[model samples]
Target: MAGRSFLLRVANVNPANVLTHTDRALYRSIGIFILLYGGYAIVGAASFVDASSNYTHPWWQWLVGPPVAAAVIAYDRAVVGRVAVNYEHLESADPHRLLRRRTAGLYTGRMVLALLFAIVITEPLMLARYKGEIDAYLGTVHNRELARLEQSGAIAAFQRQIDGLRAQDAADDAAVADLHRLAESKRSAATSAYNQALEDSRAAGVSRRAGCPPGGFCDALVQQSRSLNAEATRLDQEASTVRQAQEPARQSRATQFAALNEQIEAQRTSNRTTVESAAGFGARTAAMWELVQRDFWGFGFFYLGVAALLVCLDCAAVWLKLVSHGNGYERAEARDARRRELSELRRHQQELRVTEAATDVADAGLDTVVREQRLLDAAVSQATTRLLAELEEQTRTALTPTR
Candidate 1:
């Protein structure tokens, strides 16, 4: 009694308790019959609810779950109360009439709830699915800007500027190498000329070759030696000038490369920061919209289908409640049905036993004693038939006497 009252308090005014499964043991026991009726729909709705609970979502996303569940219970109470009303009017205009204005509210509420449940269950996964869109959008912007800089020749020009400085430096090195080679060759030639001039002076000093005294040398040989010495001094001066000029150009090239490299690195770093800084929530939302447009025909349709199914199940839960009674009513229906079945079975069993008993009696020796009783019935029937014929003849004979 205590349990019943507790259930009643929680339940609507349904004496039948068809709307609330607070005591679901009744359904589980006689579930086969319910299954035969609308059990599939009942189970489908329940399984969907359970499955929704398992969807991957943050706790915050599921904030509405508890409230939605409360609403379902509340809706259950209202429906049960309606069922009670309908039950009360079983003989009146209200019996099983769910199309009435009062009853229609139940359906409407369920339809609305179905939409809510669908939203709650799928909303979290939906967000998770598209979370990458933000990063993708930002990354694209970064890459595109870099590509634009490349396309505008800014980066290439920077590279070329560095390469030109490097080339200038290399040219300076080649110029120094050529100067060294020239100096070596010039020194070798000057040494050969001096040696040859000294030999000519020796020959010039010979008395027979120069037509002069033994100690005297030719004057032209001395002049030629002086000129060759002057040429060697000029070559040395030229080599020193080239070396001095080469050092400055090389230093200038190194300075240019270092400064330009620093500028290029800073510019790249700044551009990267700008691209990242500009990507915000608005950009991500735009990306999300793009994803929706792209996938609406594919996976987006899948979400829609899921939502529709949830709605159907929501409505199905209510329909099952209104169309069928609770386990209490169903138990009675089952019991009564079982009783009829048992009665039929017992009747058939009784008839079979009676037939078997009759056969046994006929097979036994005592069965012959009833022959006189059987003959009595036949003899009575014959006598009645003869008396009827005799009466008809006597009537006809009396009519002839009057003639």
Candidate 2:
């Protein structure tokens, strides 16, 4: 009666103690589960957040969302009170240490998971950058092509200028030829008139010497010859001056045409060079574009693989957790089996040590027995030789008795 009354009193005093302990255990288990679930959720959420935005959103913002929620929950729930109660009996033991270890492991796993997600995400991003670079290169190539076309047109125009200059030079040459012909004709006329004048003078002198009286007709003829000679000389001088002046103009026009022709040729060469350079640039740009496309396609496949791997990892984790929850007995049995294997290995090692010692003893005894047998073989040989000699002597003695 007294034992029953004591038990009732103790149970009455702490009716809620058992429930409290159970609640604390349940909460801790829930906390561990929550921690793992939260980590996975955070990882997945962060991936979504990172992928949702283009290159603009901040990564830190995505990272902070989950932790912020957890922090708020912790603050509102007074996690400190619960922590104190749960750890009251583990003051020296530090039960939270296990939680801390788990939390650390969770953090490490999350980091790895996040890194994997980032790797998968960054592939697409790098492909996008590659595409942009190739596009920009192609744009530059196109611009150069356009500029080259314009340059080619300008070169054609320069060629036309050269052609016009050549035509003008041809006209100048023709004018020069006409002037030369006119000058030559004028000089011929002048020479003829001078000769005529000389002839007239000479004839007049002959007439005077022959005693022929000089007539007014001869004087008039002389005057006419002098006037004609002077006029011819003036015309010849004017033609010669015009020819000299035309020579410089024609040479200048030819020089201008030659210079224009050189410029046109240079322009043609430059245009050709530009065209070739642009072609090279275009080829390089096209190759780069093709490379970018290839890389993008590769990245596309890589991203798909990563996504599938992530899904597989997630499914495996979920299945593992489910098995942990649903098949606790099997897991426990497996752990027990592992422990039994360890024990069995230790027992085998001990048995092997004992067997090795026994084998060493047996080998030592065999060595000693072999040495004793070698000594006994020598003694047995001596005894057998003596016995054979005695038997021979006995046979001789017996033979003599019979005689």
Candidate 3:
């Protein structure tokens, strides 16, 4: 009730406490700005901090910070030390409970608006930064892993295949060379035999004209010439066949070489793509990481600030209630003094009891005995109790319902 009373005063302090048409419109506008910006900032900071840190997020650090600040401020404003001079002019009238409710609602709206603005401003930027960093890191890692795997075995196998094809190409070239050489030798031998046969035929014609008919030697020479010519032609054809057979092998070799080139090109392209991808990912990751860090700090500060504000407000409410109800802050101060005195009194009483065990209760009452036993130590405490008793009696009389 005391806290609520303080908040009501704050609400009344606002020039536009009542919502007229124009005031209502202005209130809406304020709400929009505060909620939007506050939510944004808060969310941004929260997300950033969450992403950036490895530690568990602080769940309630903000809770105590604000209230403690507000309480100290309230205590200062209340001025608790001089109670006698500031006791007059206190009002006893209370506003309806409905007024308290309305005040609470309005205050809540403001706090929520502040929170919303925080989220709106902070969350998106932090998130973008975080995502970029993560993506880049992953891309670089993937590329490195793939490269390692290829180096381990895949690349070597590809090179081995190319080497085998090259060896086969060489064998094909040698076979083509042997076929050309055999063809040339056969042609040269055929020409030589033909020339010899022609000479023999001329000599035989002369001999026939001069004496007996041509004999077996001439026929044998002609037959041998024909056989040599036929043998040369067959050899030439066989060599041509060998050369023709080499064509498919040569073509196959060319195809194999082209395929190897294609494979190399493909690998190069793939590596280029992967590298580019990795670069992009790295950039994004760095950006996101930075964003996350920024957001984290922002949220931490914002939450802390808001919480501090709320706590101060709560303290103000209690102080305001005391002032408004005519009790004055001195009552609380006096009450605290009383509690301290009571504690001290209890300690002295305990000591007295111990001392009495050796003596007897008939000596004096507990208070008098303690007062005598520790006069200096109990003086302030005795005065505080007297003042506190008077303050309590006054507060009770004021709060009592009228007949």
Candidate 4:
């Protein structure tokens, strides 16, 4: 019984005035509708925030839900409360009541607002209901976004740079290797000629020692050995110089290759992050629509049915009030309103009468004051005329005595 009363109060009903079972039941139903919508609004708002945000906290929805639900409930209450039950027979007879009659535009505006709220709340609930299908669709979206990112201009440019650097590095390595091989081959030839010359010098010395000759062949052979030894030393020095000269170039190529590879990796990481962040509400909505388009008869119809149900729920309070216009409670309410208006009008008329009496008394007092002032002015004028006449008579007596 207490709970029922509370619900009725939520529906803006005066519990004392609710006498009929129909009024009790209807107001209770409206209240229940309001409570249900509040709960749905909370859940829907939380789901909306969770779906839309990149970083979701467990308690964040609690923070979001209550405020949004409160606002929605307040709006619902206002919408319901604005729908005045105009029992036309009673209203038409009373001029004051006629002035308070709601217009068609008011009803239309309330319904429009209710419909908008229904759409706002329904979408998130629908998204939550078909989460699995939407998730699957989102998975496809994620993969597609990733693929698109891979083929994007920036990533492609990075890959091309990396490939070019690798090719240039390989070419540089091959050129350096060929130079080293050629230098080694020339050094080997110089070393071999020196070795042969040394052997010939030893043989020529042996011939000289055996008394065949003095300084001709042996000296020539020794000098050839010396020249070949100098050539080998020079070739080794040239090879060392070539290696020293190529070291900086080799290091530079290595640095360039490494830098380009790092850049490509960074770009790839950015692309992956971009794809990962595409799982927001807008993306999910698009995915859901795609699903609807694919399975229109199944999902689309279901979607429409759910939306209609929500819209009906949201507008129920107003519609109930509108339909239950000539009910007993409304009649009582209208009667009470008319009584209060009449009492107020009577009090205003009484005040007007009191004000008129006070005004009449003040006007009479003002007239008396004017009459007294006129009498006083007449008395003062008669006294002044009498004094002047006596002065004139005294002046005539004095003149006649002088004559």
Q: For each of the candidates, give the backbone clash count.
A: 1, 0, 42, 0
Backbone clash pairs in model 2 (N, Cα, C under 3 Å; residues 3+ apart or in different chains), count: 0
Top model by lDDT, which number? 4
Could you give candidate 1's per-residue lDDT for residues 51-157 as a string of tens digits?
A: 34442333453344445455565665565434222222222332233222245665776667656655544443343445666467658867998878755555668
Q: Which ranges of candidate 3 are over 4 A from the true structure?
A: 1-153, 188-283, 286-403
Model 1 gets an lDDT of 0.55
Q: Tens-digit lDDT track for model 2 on 1-403? A: 4542332222122222223443334334434444454454455455444434433445574675487436423432232111112212222343232121112343345446545644544333333434555455656766777566646676567667767867876776566566566656655665665455455556644334322235643454456656656665665676567667767766776787778778767866776566445423235335454664668575445545655564443334223323233132222333444455567777999999999999999999999999999999988999999999999999998888542
TM-score versus the correct structure, for each prediction: 0.36, 0.28, 0.28, 0.70
- lDDT winner, 2 or 4: 4
Determine which window of 10 residues in candidate 1 has minimal summed lDDT.
83-92
Which pairs of residues clash in candidate 4, taking residues 3 or more apart in a chain or in different chains? none
**Candidate 1: which stretches are off by over 4 Å?**
1-16, 19-96, 101-153, 171-177, 188-256, 273-403
Weakest ten-residue segment in model 2 by summed lDDT: 79-88
Model 2 earns a TM-score of 0.28
In the predicted model 2, the residue pairs found to clash are none
